[model samples]
Target chain A: MRREGSPFKGLSVVAFKEAADHMASPRMHLVMLLVILTAIGSIYGAIGQIKETVGQDPFLFLRLFTTARDPLPSFMAFLGFLLPLIGIALGFDAVNGEYSRRTMSRILSQPIYRDALLAGKFLGALMVIAICLVTLWLMISGMGILLLGLPPSGEEVLRSFAFLLTSLVYSGVWLAASMLFSTLFRAPATSALAALTLWLVLTLFWGMLAPLAAGAFVPIDPFDPSTAVHQAEIAHALARLSPSTLFGEVTLALLNPATRALGIIFYSQLQGAVMGAPLPFGQSAILIWPQLASLIAGMLVVYTIAYLSFQRQEIRA
Target chain B: MSTPVIEARGLSKRYGPAIAVDALDLTVMKGEVFGLLGPNGAGKTTTILLLLGLTEPTEGSVKVLGRDPLREPLVVKSRVGYLPDAVGFYDHMSAWENLAYTARLAGLEQQDATRRIAAALERVRLPHVAQKRVSTFSRGMRQRLGIADLLVKGCELAILDEPTSGLDPQSTQELLELIGTLAREGMTIVLSSHLLSMVQSVCSRVALFHQGKVGLVGKVSELAGKVLGGSYVIELEAEGCDVPAVARTVEGVSQASRLSNGAVRVDARSDVRGALAAAIVAAGGELKRLSMDRSSLDEVYVRYFEQVDHAA
Candidate 1:
């Protein structure tokens, strides 16, 4: 026996097979249907709003992503809420499902390292997510062209494409979280619930708790206006701890060019800035670079934990 | 002699305080079918996992086909195929797809993988159901498919853990015959099973495992001969006479006893059937039946385990 080849000898095979399985799974279909219907509905609401609102807006196409109807949130908001469900659906059963189905041993027995198995699963799920994101982007842009009859500017295209990339990393964080839970729990349902519970806490409850925690950490004087500013800053920092908050801030910075900064801008900071002036693509990207890096870092951290755990796991079943 | 296909020395595995395989040494020769016989929880499965490098041993080393399994696992795995106890396949995938996935993992190109998958399915006698989902397969078919998976990988050594388990007698016979064919074609196989009769029929050499250790290891016949030490027995059925008393006085008869079935059993250091028959006839007793009793492998197996138990 010789050991000269790459450690990723079987990665493509496993990735292709897993991707096909994810594509065919009913859970994937259900999540995808939920995302697609909500996305279309959101985009439709944006288009109707554009039709009713100011007719001469230059970045009309971009507004299709950020604008919302009176009752419905924007498409970006829906994605920030729903994309994790898709990510969790794809990954919650990745490792344990193999164990439950009794295929983990057989798969590992092949001439592949554990690195390849974990890498293949993550890559396969990410591939599915990429496809879904690209399809939705194209559909929304296509529908915008059909209804609003306005071609997007180059800046609009660049900004919206950046938004899509940021969304990928955002969902990737949840996917890695789900895979981490999958590695921790042997039961697929348990892992799924665990991932979902984390998602719910971060998306819904974390916002409410961050302010209270920040108030406790940085107590403010009731009569001091500057201390109030300090409290708001603390709350903002605490909220940034959640991946959803990071994603939301990134979406705002990318989709709305008129947005200047993510945090509370002081009067001195806004002195040189023009009101209603859209930032350049480069500036907007620079503004959100930290958020992007944090999303990627969160994903890698969780995925690395899952990968190491999987490597150390006993392959009995 | 050719080099051993597998070698393990002082190999041990401990899960917390429970020892699964303890300081075991095993060597398997090339092109021979080796059997690991043990009852449940006797470390047969753990030993297989250790040999495959699926789990790290606590205390020793293993070399499969001249490569250290721990250091060169992919190399060893590429040459070895393992069919775990109660083997499983992707239930939603067709048999061909399942085999093709393995072939791809083994690094075969598409054209080569397709050709080999077809050949393997045909070899396992399951080419007709190549496109059917595995969930719809019978147990025998799934077991045969497991073999096909090994075949497609072109593994030099096939490790089958309880291969005939859960199969009907007819299926077991067929699987045994298939194993025989593979062995004759010069494939080294390591088979583990608790079924002594099945192991005796197929294994050229065997290691009887007890309490996480090999209690006995040798050729079946050699172990029987060594343990029994040339002692032989003769059974006789006689009527109208004191058969047990007369048989006890025969030359070379060490012990004689009347069995519950009205047959007299005589243990002898030499062949005593002819002498016993002659004495019975001379005593005016009717000789109903006379036959030499051969020591079965089952007896050797039972005695070996009993002796080990007593020593423990």
Candidate 2:
């Protein structure tokens, strides 16, 4: 059944058209609208406050803008949570919407392979997210320059870009998650619900639930702060298995480079140091690497499941 | 002779414990319209699915254009256009957008894709409202868009499943005309329908499926020749007479059904009019009416199916 050369000449033509149709869809319009509103709102909100904060102390603006110093919980919260949600929203309907449109079967009937469909969709959604996120990031920085009246240090600029890369990768994880759900469920509503349920598990419940479970099994006292934090860290690792929160955690770490990496509960910075202290970044990364690996592995696992399921599913359905 | 565009040798499909199609052999030659006629649960759709490689065969092999659809589906599929029983379209897209999408997938260059999109819409007579979203299109229009999608592929073999299922008489007529034109253009077509009249009118040959098997297959005329033998049946107003002797005089007459009221019916091999007329005149009986009747497709379909049960 082998063709001597490439066979998708006509199929690519068709897939390309479907991909274009995807771009002009109403869902793209809605995502863009939300992105525009978020950028405008965030920029103006910073503008409204930048003056007073700058006047209060000459160093205040420098610390906030030029360095990661005094990074507020609210900024981290917005960057960590809202951006990933946007990624999810962009992709939640990807496969399921195609299924609903009845274009999926038609496309499959062509010579285009199944993976190309997924790849095209992922690329399209990523481009859309890139546009929105990049716009927002630039808008915020522009507002900072105008109001704070301070230039970002080279270090700050480098870190911001690093943070942006981290944010993009983090968003991709959610997009994959959303698409995985899309393939798992046939109905768009069900796919949306499944994605949100994952979000809630990662964002709200996983953090609290893991610690409680570990604590229950260990049955340690709160006065033992180290023990409790250990449990929380373990719980966080377990929770990070949910790609959404793992991405959020990774992005937060990138935004503020001072924070310790996530993974194992380090007894102290010492690997049998003369005296045990908090773990160093090397030890922390070593500990966190496993969790990171696990999170990446989990994404692949779900994606693989979706791929196999789709390959196996009959066109009759 | 045209090459066989679709060839299947003992094709079969089983959905777990249920056998959807069983040991079915078929071949559809190029540039001819063939039909698979059956009722709703009689496996017309299953046979089509097997041909498209949408479902794997449980027992036998299928080759379209000399390629196994299961193994080289992309190559075969690229050359084959399929319109499922219910052609589904994205409701949000206009007919033009939908056609454009399919055309691109069919591997037409941007320029050619646009050209074919227009031509297909025109062929279906849907060019005027090309930009109208399928959501607002009536059932007939949606079906038209569906046909346009299949045609845009520019494939050699076209498969239409339940093409006229819900169509009104006018739309059905138009669709039939379009099909006639495609056939004239030498496009190999596989038409599945439950409408015997439609099949009888357009199909050169047919494969009748029943309970997951091809119960019968032959040229429509040949099948008609074998199943519908020479016979004449007429209701008559007649007084008492020698009905058997009148029947015997007709050459090759096999049997006759005589009503108690003296109306005579006869089954014969050749034209029985002269012998019957001579017998009638000699016997002093009046021939009220005479007409000929042959075995119909409906009866052949019934007889073949009943034979399946008897053999089982």
Candidate 3:
């Protein structure tokens, strides 16, 4: 049977309310502070390095993200490490927090369906994250122009924009993962812990686990040299299962235009290529198209799981 | 006759192997304070959820404000206001902000929301604390804010779950008066509580819920007559007379017996004090005192449940 009325009738209302709450919250403020301080520290080191090697690079502005000096990682590396933290912090208590505060039933009793609530919360947090990312991007570019004494090339600006977009989608994967846990677990702390544990395992240990899993699937054979290639291929495929791996591959391809391929490339594949020549922006994006698709698909899958569970859950906590 | 504001037929809810609400039927008319009186876990809150379309029922149907709640939830919900048991608000937001959030969700214009929110807070006598964060408010104040949330939406029907559960007697009294005022203003109200005295004071009619089913439904006086066999009780303190014998001589007296406290307790169909006094005087007895007891919901609830338990 068909239900009456649009399930999205009050969607913007819920979204605007949630986004306002997040923007005003001390948690978002503290997280944004950590991000800004890290950006300043990393970009400071990058500018010093870029100044020393100014004449050698075509994409000097892009180097602001990739170049790093001692005691600090690259700006892109910091984002890869911290974007998941931002996403998790925003979503680990989305639904259960309402239950803890004893507001779930009251909110659900409004004229909207549960579909509006779950989707609105996700959209609202994503909007906040997007705003934070755009602000940081503008700051980094503004700092690059002021410090480097030159504007970025059109190609360099295009590649950097792609990098920013990839980072946002990467964060979406983690946000959806935590929202799924929030729907599954009643306690906010438990959901946060679970999301963090998954993040730690994927970010830190998945690199190690991939090879072991691949070795079991396609064991190395001493008699056949081709077996080694097969093992490496299997390992690469296994690593791609982790969203962190997908995000890293996408970031590498987008920010570094010279990157032609993601996985196990043979010497024969680069035999006729011009060494150190940066690919066009479209080519680099095309190279990471599958990785980008995987990141987006992973986010949608996790978010869909959360939505279904939340729809079926009892509103009474 | 008043039109029904809420109607449910054969409504049931199940959580796995356990039944939260069985096949039950109920109807609440417009402009009446209807009480769902029962112990905790008796399906009162579940029924409210079903009526509001917050949860789907496993069987049967419900209509609120002439619309099917399951099929047309927006219509039902927009016209209905619900205050959950131990209702909560965002602790960090001011009372007006909290109500404004719900007003927006209900699709009110900005200016309309502002005006209605002020009027609602004033109606609940909470205007002074409208700008204060909810965390600083007492439980009674929080409950009043829940009511104000309803008023801001201009809902035609209000369903309250245990609104007076955790309050002191003074707060309960104030809340009941507010509910009475709302009813007087032509708002249909359905409130559930295990507190018999509170429900008895505010509800024009009550349904006694037992194990996910309503065993009896009527006015409190009617339930008392049905369960306790009489609606009035008379206590007589007399000297130089047989009190039970004199009371038995009066018409409409159902039962008469002498108490250990030396008072004759008489159960009657109605207030038979005048006839009983005349009979006592004719019997040459000097009456010291005569009084009639009002029928109480507490007695009806206890006696009804006792009978049910014995049968079970």
Choose the strongest candidate by DockQ.
Answer: 3
How do the residues A85-174 of candidate 1 rate in per-residue lDDT, one tens digit apiece? 989999999999889878888888899998898889999999999999999999999999999898899999999999999989988999
TM (B chain), model 2: 0.83
> TM-score winner among the candidates?
3
Reference-based lDDT, residue B9, model 3:
95
| Model 3 ranges off by over 4 Å | B231-294
Q: Candidate 3 on A105-162: residue-level lDDT in tens? A: 9998888888999989999999999999999999999999999887989988888888
Q: Which stretches of candidate 1 lie over 4 Å from their true place?
A: A1-5, A223-226, B226-295
A138-170 per-residue lDDT for model 2 (tens digits) = 766776777666666555565566556556666
Residue A64 lDDT (model 3): 92
Cα lDDT of model 2 by residue, B58-130, tens digit: 8889989998887877788889888876677878778887777666665578898888888989999999999
Which residue pairs collide in model 3, if any? none
Error of 2 at A108 (Å): 1.7
TM-score of 3: 0.94
User: Ignoring the other chain, what TM-score does chain B have in each prediction?
Assistant: 0.89, 0.83, 0.90
